[model samples]
Target: MADALLEFRGVNTYYGDLHVLKNVDYSIGRGEIVCLLGGNASGKSTTMKTIMGVVRPQSGQVLYDGQEIADLATSERVKRGIAPVLEARRLFPRMTVYENLEIGAYTRKKGPEFDQDLERVYQLFPRVKERRTQISGTLSGGEQQMVAIGRALMSRPKLICMDEPSMGLSPLFVEQVFDIIQEINKQGVTIFMVEQNASMALSIAHRAYVLQTGVVVLSGPAAEMKENEMIKQAYLGEMQVEAA
Candidate 1:
C-alpha cells in the first residue's frame, strides 16, 4: 500500500439498480502480477471497468501512480497509460490487425513514438504482424485474443488489466496466452488480471485475491493459494480428500 502503483479504496459501483462492486479494496505494486479470482458475477469485470473509468464509482477512490484517477473518463485513463483487454476480445470486425492496433495508439501519436509503439506490439505478437493485412473477423479465436492484447499494448500502458484472457482457448492456446501475459509483465507493466481459470491464474500470478458475492474471501501469494485445500478442491480440479 505504501508503494502501490495502483490502489482502489472503498470502491462501490452500480449498474442501474444493481450494485455490482461493494466497498472493493485492491492494490497492485509496480510491475507485479495480481489476479482477481472469482466465479460468475463476482464483480471481477466491474473492477476492471471501474479502474478504466468505463463505470463510475459513486463512493470510492482509484489512485494510480499516487494520483486520484476516479474522475478521469475511459479515454482519459487510457491517455494516462492504463490499458484493458476485456473478456469478449473487442476487435474491429472489418478492420485489419494493423488497424485495430493503430486505434490503440490514438493517444500516443507523436512522430516516431507511434511507429515505435507499433513495432513493440508487433514484436509482442508476431501473429498479428503476419496477418497485418488480413481482416480481424476471419482470424481464429486464439489469434483474435492476440490482436486484443496487442492492441492494448500499442498504448504503451503502465498498467494492463486483462479480463479473462483465456476464456475460450484450447489447452495449448491457454498456456500460450498465459505465457504471453507473463512476458508482457516482464516488460515493466503492472498487471491486474481477472480470470475464471483459477488453476492457471494461481500458477502464474505473484499474488491473488479470491472474491465471492462481491467480497474478497481470500488473499495470499500464488504458491500458497495453489496449495490451499479449498482452492485445490474447487477450482484447481478435484483432488482426493486427504484421508478423512
Candidate 2:
C-alpha cells in the first residue's frame, strides 16, 4: 500500500529444521490497528519476532516506513521507532516502576524530550504513575500489564507491536486493556498486535489476518472478518447455519 507503515513481503521463517512462517505477505497502514490472530504454534509469536528482529527471516523483507529493517539489530529497530510489548508482561521484577519505564528509553538520548515522553506514558496510565516507586513484581497482573504498555510507550515509538496484551488477565482487566489499546490508536500510534482471543481482537482492530498452521487463511476488514462463517465457527466458537 502507498501509505503502509509496515510491510512483510514474502516472509518465510524457520526454527531449526522446522518451518514457521510460510511466505507471508501483509501490511499495516499508518495510524491503523491491525491484529494477527491464530491458535497455539500457529506462528503468531514468530511473526512478531521477525518484525522486531529477534528472529531474522530466512528469506524476504520486513519493511518499516519503506526502509528494509530485516537485518537491523533489535535495539536498532527500537531506534527506528518500533517498540514491542512482549508476551507475559516481562518487567524487571526487582526494579521500581519508574526504573522499568526509564529502561524503555535507553535507545534515546536522555534529555527534556525523554522526560516529556515519560510524562506522556504516565498520563496514559495513571495507575502506573501512582505506583512509580513500588516494585514491579509486587503489582497485580493488570497493573503489571499496564506497566508493560507504559514502558513500551516510553520509547515514543511510531509503531507498537503488542504480543498477547490481554493474556493471563482477568475478564475485567482484559476489557480495560482493550479499551486502552483503542485509545492509544486514536492518539496516532499505529498498532500491530498478535492475539489468540479472536473475538476481542477483532472488536478493536481496524483490520485482521488469520494465521493457520503458519499460513494466512483469511485477511480483511475486521467487521467483515467477524461476520465470516469460518472465522465465527473456528475462532469465535459460534455455529453458522447454511440455507437448506
Candidate 3:
C-alpha cells in the first residue's frame, strides 16, 4: 500500500530453538482497521510482540511510517505513536482507573493536551469515567478491558495495536468492544489487531491476514476473506459451532 503506516517485510523471529514467525509480511495502511487472525501457537501474539519491540526478529524490516524500527526501544516506539492494548488487558491492578490512564501518557510532557486526551478517552468509555476512582483490579473483566483501551488512547497514538481484544469477555461485552474499535478507527487512528474472534474482527476490519504455524496463509479484503471457503471451514466453522 502506498500509504502504509506499518509494514513487516520478511520477518523471521525465534525463541531459543523454537521458530515463532517465519517470513511474515503485512502492510497496515493509514486509517485502516487491519486484523491478524489465527489459532493457538500460530504466532499471532508474537506478531504483536515484534511490533511492540518486546521481541525482535532475527532478520527483516519492521517499518513504521516508512522508518525502520525493528531495533527501536518499546518506549521509543510508543513515543513515535505506536501504542498497544496488550493481550488480556494488562493493567496495574493496584492503580485506580484514572491513574492507569495517566501512565499511558508517560512519554508525553504534561499539558492541556493530556487533559484533552483524558476527556477523549472518557467520551469513548463512560464506564471508565464512572469508575475513575475505583481500583482497576476490582473492576469486572469488561470494565478492565475498557480501561486498557482508554489507557492506550491517552497516548494520542496514530496507530493502536490491540491483542485479543475479545479474549475474555461476555458476548455482549465483545460486541461492545468491537463497536468501540470501529468508532476508534472512524476517528482516524489506524488499528492493527490480533484476534481469535474471526467473525467479529472481519465484521469491522478493512483487511485481514490469516496465519498458521508461523506463516501467513491468506490475506485480502475482509469481505473476500469472510467468503473464502478455506476460511469458512477452518475459522468460521468453529465460530458457528460455538454459536450453535
Q: lDDT winner among the candidates?
A: 3
Model 2 global lDDT (CA atoms, 0 to 1): 0.90
Note each model's CA RMSD in angstroms: 3.2, 3.5, 0.8
Higher-scoring candidate on lDDT, 2 or 3? 3
- For 1-244, candidate 1 gives per-residue lDDT tens digits of 3279999898888899888888888889898899998878989998998888888998888999999998888999899889999978999989998899899888875578888878887787788899999999999999999999988988889999999998888889889889989998898888899987787787789999888878888888889998887777666763233111
Off by over 4 Å in 2: 238-244
For model 2, residues 34-144, the per-residue Cα lDDT tens digits are: 999887899999999898899999998899999999779999999888999988788999999999999999988899998898888888888999999999999998999
Residue 41 deviation, candidate 3, in Å?
0.2
Off by over 4 Å in 3: none
How would you encode candidate 3's per-residue C-alpha lDDT over 1-244 as one tens digit per residue? 5399999999999999899999999999999999999889999999999999999999999999999998799999999999999887889999999999999999999899999999999998999999999999999999999999999998889999999999889999999999999999999999999988899999999999999999999999999999999999888999989878
Displacement of the residue 211 alpha carbon in candidate 3, Å: 0.4
Distance from true location, Cα of 3 in model 3, Å? 1.0
For residue 83, give model 2's deviation from the true position in Å: 0.4
| TM-score per candidate | 0.93, 0.95, 0.98
